[model samples]
Target: MKAIKSFSIGLIFFVVSSCGSLNPINPLSLLMGNSWALSSLMGKSLDLSQFADGVPSLNFLEGGKLAGFTGCNNLSGSFALEGSSIRLDPGAVTRKACPGTGEQDFLGALSKVGNLKIGKDKLTFLNGEEELMSFIPKED
Candidate 1:
């Protein structure tokens, strides 16, 4: 009985120690601040700056709110974060037609995003397991 108790205690300690914690930045923190455009692609890298209308912009607010000019129309949407997964609620945009390959690409990429991964300097929007777009921080 004594040996069995010792083994159980050891096993418990090992199990507890082996488990890791999720230290992902609080989703609220991500939402409360601004995120800039780094790179974007649904299938290929598109010029992110062009979409900003010379604004160098990419920003997201709390509660999944997002906005930026894709060198065309302004885009915005509601987003949700669950653990490591993200869901972009159907986004809306201005109806004015944007002229340029960059605009078309930006529109395509935004429509496909289904998840998001935030890094210290980058936020990667993903569709399933593949990256759809990436955002970097701009100096204020």
Candidate 2:
């Protein structure tokens, strides 16, 4: 029957179209709602004892909000993402009379971050092609 044949064709078209509508995994999903702890700075491993706090860490929140600890003062900022590129704007930092210049170094490096890459177990921030900092997922 013509009606049966037309129905079959329509069903096939619907199935094909539904498959096409499925979107690929979004990279933002990997970055949002995740926390990363500072692991290495400028290719050098950090000595946690140097920090008064346990370790510097970052938490990426919804709506581009950023919160972290700089090993001395609390860090707050806003971040924007475009594809794999990122821009972090450092905001208010508590005056805690940090002993060394490590906090300053961390914030300074943060300001220069131009992009980011998320790997299997690492998140890396880079300025162009040079890696500025790297982080590991904060254990919950």
Compared with the true structure, model 1 gives a TM-score of 0.66
> Which pairs of residues collide in candidate 1?
51-70, 51-71, 64-79
TM-score between model 2 and native:
0.79
Off by over 4 Å in 2: 1-25
* RMSD of every prediction: 4.8, 4.7
Distance (Å) between predicted and true CA of 98, model 2?
A: 0.6
Total clashing pairs for each candidate: 3, 0
For residues 1-140, write the lDDT of model 2, one tens digit per residue: 99999999999999999998997656567776468899988778987766777789888888888889999899788899998899988688888887776787789899999999886578999999998999998998
Which candidate has the top score in lDDT? 2
Query: What is the per-residue lDDT of model 1 for residues 7-126, given as tens digits with 9 covering 90 to 100?
Result: 999999988887765464775576446557646566456554555464324576755676666666677777666776766643777777655567666666667777777766777888
Best by TM-score: 2
